[model samples]
Target chain A: MTPLPDAPAAPTAPRQPARRLRRFSRAERWVHRGTAWLMGICVFTAACLYLPPLSELVGRRRLVVTVHEWSGLMLPAPLIAGMFFRALRADLSRLNRFGRHDWHWLRTVLRKRSKEGVPAGKFNAGQKLYSAFIAGAVLVMIGTGLLMWFTHLAPVLWRTGATFVHDWLALLLAAGITGHVWMASKDPEARLGMRTGSVASWWARREHSLWKPDDKD
Target chain B: MEEPRVDDAPDDPGEENERHGAPVGRRVVLGMLGLGAAGVALGSHVQDRIDAVLAEVSAKDPTGVTGLLPGGGGFRYYSVTSSVPKRNAENYRLTVGGLVDRPMTYRLADLQAMPQQRLVHDVQCVTGWRVPKTAFSGVRLSALLAASGVRPEATAIRFDCFDGAYTESLTLQQARRSDVMVALTMQDKPVTHAHGGPVRLYAAPMYFYKSAKWLSGITLTKSVEPGYWEKLGYDVDAWVGKSNGRSDDPTS
Candidate 1:
């Protein structure tokens, strides 16, 4: 085989069309980042509660438990704030709204098929599933955590159940979030879209075909 | 420039089909299904009071149980999550040294050869729950200490757990309690990894914290070294109801 193209001649794609999509506005970005940090604090404090090694790591159980309580309390603050961003709110509300393509998307996901093989959009069936679970899980965690944290509104038995639900749901959430991370990490295109707000033109066509702009315009 | 809603179907099917339309009906069905899934989990949670009673009365943990309860599945059931694996009867050993006249080193077989004692009591955590009446079987730590002939100068016993993080201590008097045992077996079978297995310390009257998991080292000394938890600000003497200062019902 002949030697191929030389290094100096490599045609690099530039900021020709300024491809960055203004997908998330500043308000949406703030809400997203705030919740992300709050959730992160909760997770780390929770680790302190489970592992004996981390008891000293956080100083006291009360501190860890207190932080856990506050984290749970703060979890929905950002999402609630997101409601003010009409466009992003509309986008998320739309995600929760299932559609015809979602059935096809679900079938493709269930059958071990490639995302490339299916037509999709800004949020596929799977991303919708994540947002739905995360939203629901956070809500459950908040409500139950409050029950356990306070003594006046409920009985002792209620506290016990709340504690149980809090812990087991924590385990379940851990498992579910692992799958979430794997999906987001595996698709470089998806990762880039949220991280830097851009995607390869070809990637948009294959992964989120319905969202692709009309270039003929 | 903007994405179209997948559900933006025309009001009339007579207006045409997927040939040029969004599938609104299909979207509604799927949205209903997602809501249904969330609804199921939410409904179960909302009946929290009823569910709590049912669980407390009937729940049986799949893992081995410990502590005081109708079924022994309380939290004091010790299990290792990670360890120096592949130990066996021929290799495992327990040493009684430091302030003992006889610094005896007993192999796994040696421990089994010795006499045994069983304790049935609540396993209480410092946090204020007591799982009462869980059964534990092993030689009392005092029995082993007596057999080793602990020196009169020895005033405390320190336990080192295999977890690399858990350390616990007991006063000489507490260490000698008939209820304190370096436990060998739980629930009539070998302890599994989920509950600290092989060997562990079971101090019945105290908070479950004293029941160190993966118990490997015991040193008799003149004074107590505050335990790993104690050093980190947990009450040094972590009695079930007293330690955390909460009055929740004791867990055995």
Candidate 2:
């Protein structure tokens, strides 16, 4: 319309390469990996301790006890250390807060409905719930483990209850971890995100459309 | 970004009712709670029944493995010998000698007649099982040591068992704790042979190994001698939660 102004040729947008989205920061990934390894050792050593055949095969009860106790004691170390990182703290806060969307997502998943309409942000409702559960479990385990270790400090009833809870929760945790591994295996991209701290942008958009990076650069 | 809307109608009307059925959720939660309570009650009942059966089986078991199974009161019977030696109260004798000013031998009755002290303590094993609040009534070890007039140079106490092979020891200081006793009864009843009866050393704060079973001798020594399990790699000190490089909870 403005031949006179010959309208500055419509400004061309600069072309950019498609880049991977940052899913988990380096510190977050490290905390996850460290806790995962420690938890694996704890569960394995505990099995060795309780199962007669496993105990006999493993032998060296003293060594196994030491490994189990120390690994359990250190389970929370990485998470505690990661609190110093801003991104991790933010992510943790996000995980801790449950909203209507989360409830909706949980309902959809529980009913085996397509997750297509579920509104999830950086972490899905299932992931958030699992994170919260694991954090609570870690604390409970540490408390009970210490009581068991320092036998004289607590009353017999408390110790007994602690042992009961610890044992049952351990079994539950094992099952939960197995399910988590299966899910992760099914979604290789999720595993890739944890391992490499990034995921394909399209994968993130499809799986977590609500997760918009603040700075695409 | 705008927050996701929760009030939007679910894709299927039937699904909404199924998903948000509070009455169903409540019933499920209540059912789970009821099941849990029932489970606990059933567990205790089963435990009691199992204990009774185990107790009966232990009375006849020669291998002692059946006795090692955990019972209702956290008690387990562990015997190192093939069979519990037949020792009646009339036949049992406890001898205290070596480096002591007064060497004395007393029948089970004589030890039982001494001023008795009752204590409840946890019985800890090197293998990791624990029985709590086990009651033991007997003459205090300190009282016995005092009555025997321990010699100053006698730095340790050696224990010999009627089982013939098992032996244990304690330092002069350890043998004197208020909790240590030459126990004649356990759980308010006479100690059973399978449990190291007619009389056994009750080192309350130490592991069960340090509490020599089937006590037949207590000899004062110039130095500490490791016990049977101790000789075979168990901790000599065997303090609850402190020995064996394990900080187990004290069983006191």
DockQ of each: 0.07, 0.03
What tens digits encode model 1's per-residue C-alpha lDDT throughout A96-201?
5554666567776677756765766566677777777777678777777776566454655455555556765677777787888788789887677666645566
What would you estimate as the lDDT of candidate 2? 0.72
Worst 10 residues of 2 chain B by lDDT: B13-22
- A1-217: candidate 2 lDDT, tens digit per residue: 1121212344453554445777788999999999999999999988776654465456455567779999999999999999999888767656655455566677777787667656566766778767756766676677778867876676554555455556656767788889888889888989999999888777877777656554321
Query: For each candidate, what TM-score against the reference?
Result: 0.54, 0.53
Instruction: Assess each prediction's global lDDT (C-alpha) against the native.
Output: 0.64, 0.72
Which segments of model 1 are wrong by more than 4 Å? A1-22, A26-165, A168-217, B1-86, B125-133
| CAPRI-style class, candidate 1 | incorrect
Native interface contact recovery, all models: 0.00, 0.01
- In DockQ terms, which candidate is top? 1
Error of 1 at A38 (Å): 7.6
Expressed as tens digits, the lDDT of each residue in B105-131 for candidate 1 is 777677777788877776666533445
- Per-model chain B TM-scores are 0.68, 0.71
